[model samples]
Target: MSPPVTAPAGRKKTLSHPKKANNMPRQPRTFKAFIVLCAIALSSPFTTPATQNAQAQQNRAVQNQMQNDPDTGSKKGWWSGLPREKKMLYTTTASAAAIAVWGLATWDYGSSSGFHTAHEGAFEENAKYGGADKMGHYFATYAISDMLTGLYKSYGYDTRKANNYGVLSAWAVQAFMEIGDATSESQGFSWEDTMMNTLGALTSILMARYPALDDKIDLRVEYIANVRIGGIFDDYSNQFYSIVLKLDGFDFIKNNFLKYLELSAGYYTRGYDTDEVKKRRSVFAGVSFNLSRFFYQKHYNKTGKVLEYLQLPYTVLKGSRDLD
Candidate 1:
C-alpha cells in the first residue's frame, strides 16, 4: 500500500482507517450557545441589587401560594396591610431599580451620554421608516408591555381587568419614558416609538379582554376549561394594522380584519422559559405584596384585613379548595 498513503497536513486523516465511516455528518454549528451567553450578559446588569431583593420577596410569596394551593394553582395573598411608610419604600425602591435597569440598558458605555448611538437613527429610524411590517416593532411592543406587566404583577396589582387599566398603565409608563427621551439631547421623538408603544398597549388590553382567539394566535393552548393564556396574539396584529393606517399610511390587512380573529382550546399548556419565568414570578409576587400593603393600609387599615390577607395563603393551603 506504499507505506499507507499520508493524508494532507491540514485535514483530519480519518479516511486512513477504512473501518471508520467518513459519512458521519459534521458537528452542527451552534450560534445558540453564543446567543445564550450574550443574552445572559445583556440581561445581567438589568437585574439590579434592589430588584434582586424584591425578587426574593416575590419568590417567598409564590412559594407560599404554591404551598397554599398545591393543586388549586390560585395565587395567595401576602401584602394585605403593610404600613404606609413600608409601602412607599417598597414602591420607590422597586421603581427606581427598574428605572436603573432601563437606563443602563439604553446607556452607551463609551461616552457619558451622546445624541446618538453608533448606528445613530439608522436602526431605530429604519424600524420606524419601514412601517409596521417589521418584527422589531412587534418585539419592542411585546418587550415593553411584557416587562411592565411583569413588574406591576410583581408589585401585587391584580391586573385582571374588564376595563382598560392595564393598557392605561402600560401606555402611561411607556409614554412617560418616550416623553423623557424626546426631550433629551440625543434621541428625539421618533414616530416609530410612539406607534410601537400605542400598538403594544392596545394589544395587551385587547388580548386581556379576549383571551381565546386563534388566527392571530402566537401560542394557542388551554391549561384548563375557561382558564387559558396566549390565545389572542391578534390583538397585537390589530395594533399593527392600526399603526400602519395612522403612521405608516397603509391598510392592506384591513379587509381580513374580521377573519383574522382566532380562538384556541386545549387541555395542556406550556409555560414560559423556566429560569426567567421563575425570576419573573418572584418579581411579580414582591411587587404584588408591596402594592397590596400600600392599598390595603390606605383603605382598610382600620379593618385589619392585612393580617387576614397574609393568613389567607395559609387558609387556602389548609383548605385545599379549587381556585375560585
Candidate 2:
C-alpha cells in the first residue's frame, strides 16, 4: 500500500514581500533540463523490450503462486488472528487518537475560547495559498481512503466491505482533524475544506468500486525540491496537485508508443509561502511520461504504486495559465 500524504490542518500568517523580478527567465532553462531528463528516462535500460518481457514473466509467476499456495491463507492470520472488523476498529481509533495528540501539541488545539468556524474561500484568487490548501485537503483524504482500502483488504475484508470502511474511516479521521481545528487558536473549521474532503473520499470509493476508472485516472502531487524551510506537505508554493489521465488505460493505446504518455492538468500557487505581494495562482496542462506504468512493466511494483499518488518532478513539460 502507498503511504498517505498528510495535509497540514492549520494556517499561519506570513509577512508580505515584493515579488522577484528575474523569476520569469529561469523557466525556459528548467524546462529544457526536464526534457533532457525525460528523454533519458524513456530510453533507459528499464524500458527495454527484453527487460519488460522478463519482468512480465516474473510477475505472472508470482501471481500464480499467490493464487495457488495454501500457505497464503495461513499467513493471513499472522497479525494476532484478529477479526477483520476488530482490526479496522482498532486501527481507526489509534490513528485518530495519534493525530489528535499531534494536533493538540503543534496546532494549538484547545487554546481558543470556544469552538469556531472559518470562512476560507474556495479556489478564489485571493483565497489562502490561492486554494492550494483546498486541493491538499482533497488529496489527503483521497490517498488516505485508498491506503485504508488496502489495509482492510489485508485484514480479510471483502472488496466492497474494505472500500466502504476505507471511505468512512478516511472521512471520520479528516472530520476529526477539522473539529480539532475548530478548537484551535490559530485555526478554525472551514466548510470548504470539509466539502473537498468529502468529495475526495467519495472519489476514492468510486475508484475502488471501478477498476477501469482507477487505472485511467490518478490524483497526484508533484513536489519540487527546494531549500524551503518547512516540510513538503505544507509547502504550497513548491507543490502541484494534478489529475493524470493515463493513455494506456484505453485499449486502443495500450499496445502502442502512446501507452508511455499521460495527460495532466493541475493547479499550484507561487510566492504563497513567502507571502509575496504578487501571489500567483496558475493552472497548467502538460504531457508526462507514464513512469508508474513503466515501473510496473519493469517489475518495480512498489515504486510504481508510490508513483500513482506522487508525481515525479521534472517529468513533465507544462504550459501554465495564471489565474492571478
Q: What's model 2's overall lDDT? A: 0.67
Candidate that would win on lDDT: 2
lDDT of 1 by residue, 4-115 (tens): 0000000011112211232421110011111222232233222222344676787688769767878634333345345434543464345345533543454211222333
Of candidate 1, the 10-residue stretch with the lowest lDDT total is 1-10
The local lDDT score (0 to 100) that residue 165 gets in candidate 2 is 92
Instruction: Please give the CA lDDT of all the candidate structures.
Output: 0.29, 0.67
Instruction: Quote the positional error of residue 240 for candidate 1 in Å.
Output: 15
Instruction: Kindly report which residue stretches of model 1 are placed more than 4 angstroms away from their true locations once superposed.
Output: 1-138, 143-159, 162-165, 214-216, 219-324
**Candidate 2 structure quality by residue, lDDT tens digits, 1-324:** 222444222233211222122221100011221222233223222222334467557757865976899676567545545767888998788778976887676666686688866776877786756777778777777777776776676565656787799789878977887798787545667788889889989988888777788778988878787636354434567778899999888987647789888999999888766646788999999999989888888877555766777788788899999985
Q: Model 2 TM-score?
A: 0.77
Candidate number achieving the greatest TM-score relative to the actual structure: 2
